[model samples]
Target: MSRRRLPELTHHGDRLPAQEERERVDMLDGRVGVEERACRGLLDGRLGASVFLVRSPGVVDGRGELVACTPEACSRWVRAAAEYVIVVNDVSAELEAAHRRAASVPWWRYVAAQRAFRDWKTIARRYEEVTREAAEAYEPVAREIGRALAEMVEIAAQERARQQDETRRHRSVLAARAFWGWSEVTEAGRRAVYVFRHDVPRDDAPEGAAPEESPHVDLRGLRRAIVDLDLPDVRWDGAALAETERELAGIGFGRWWRDLFHEDFRTFTAPPPARGSSSGRSSPSGGTATGGTGGFSGGFSCGGGF
Candidate 1:
């Protein structure tokens, strides 16, 4: 069957009335005071037992401080900070049963009663058993997620440092220009300073100041570096993302009883969670959850691809 093309998404657009249309939110919606996140687990709107892995972009909330960037401006750092991931999902048992049951009877009453239980307690007992088994099987996938996040954390740190240094270099030239009286705050607009410290004659050196170890960076140099800086040219590894998911199914999270949640691939989900709700637990079928389940859609393999 041909796949459906998803429309643009917006942050919190789900809260809008069903009739309202909105734009898609940027993958890196770096609003102030938000933090980065990585996740692996069950999501809402699915049936049976299934687990998902996610590496959504995080925000740079300055907290209470006034931020330099506008709410509409996505942070370049956020994109640099973004990581790739793969996620898997399935149809929930209740929903899957609803689908099959609806095929026979009116679509309105999807939940039909199965064979009568020997005792009412038996039903609750069975649910608890299914939940327990799911939790047990998910341990390895969870551990793998931890390992993956750790690896990504190291990578993020390096990226953050590189970006910060770039920011500092760009600012350094401006600061130096002001210090040298080239970009002085005068009645005339600030003057542009193209001269460097070394270009000035020795007599121009500050009295008694020793020679410098390195030249103060210039705007030209900063611009050149900005242009030449190597950006990573790949998305998250679909194969690797697919592998963890393979382990999840191999471990039997999707096979509990009916395995209703099982699908060929996931659908396009909204962007990953903000830090606070980013990482939490949920059940494949139904059970208590720390954070409410979020929605996701998958087209192919994992690693945070469309």
Candidate 2:
């Protein structure tokens, strides 16, 4: 079937009639408003229009030549373009063509639709069973492992602080050696004296006296101690395994029910309770009759052998 084109009205004359110019302007404005409204409606989830406008030299040239690019090329161009221009020459015909093309079913889609329910049920059941079994089997072990891991983390933090202190000490010794020089101790302290004169005085010392210092110890012993204090391997018990299994089972069963039923069970709704009338009256069993107004408050006779 032939496509119907959109009505086009143009005003070219320099001294065109006011009515003609107004008509043209109105048409253009209407088209712009339609496009904007469509975009807004789509964003707001109120409409489902897939029309896209492109405003690029390439698209203009293609439209002029009535050329259709490959889907991949069109996508790339659209992404790269800054503006989008309207070019709906035959909306109905284009829509019909798309419908015809979509009428052909793809093999994968058919297969997927056929297996979707079965797959959902199967997966749900399998996960539920597995989680239940795992929870039963591993809860106690998981708890024990968690406790051990926490302990290991605490030990690691402590060790890290100790290692940092050791590193700082080593760097301090290197800085001291650089400042004091090689001959500070053996060569009658000439180099040391020269360095001291140039450097700022230590906080603990008098202006002329050398800084009192601790005897230097090698870092090899410290490194060995750090290495020996490695994190101990964690062991799990039956109780921890049991606890983990229970948690896993809970999660798995919930998911399984949801998937199998294809409905959310997490939310529960209870109907409101039935209301009674303000009036009171005696029921057959001497209880207040519902929605009635003749009872004890109204001075009705009591059942005291009157």
Query: Where is model 1 poorest over a 10-residue stretch in terms of lDDT?
Result: 12-21
**Candidate 2, superposed: residue stretches over 4 Å from native:** 1-123, 170-306
Could you tell me the lDDT of residue 112 within candidate 1?
33
lDDT of each: 0.29, 0.28
TM-score of 2: 0.20
TM-score of every candidate: 0.26, 0.20
The model with the greatest lDDT is 1
Which 10 consecutive residues of model 2 have the lowest summed lDDT? 13-22
The alpha-carbon lDDT assigned to residue 230 of candidate 1 equals 22
Question: For residue 251, what is the lDDT in candidate 1?
Answer: 28
Q: What lDDT score goes with residue 121 in model 2?
A: 39
Model 1 C-alpha lDDT per residue in residues 1-306, reported as the tens digit of each score: 001111111111111011101322234333232232322222222233322222222322322111223433323322222211111112123323333333344333324322221222243345345544654565454454445446556877899999878755644433334211111111122211121134333322222234344344543342232223322111111222233234333322112211322221121123234356533333342111211121121132222211
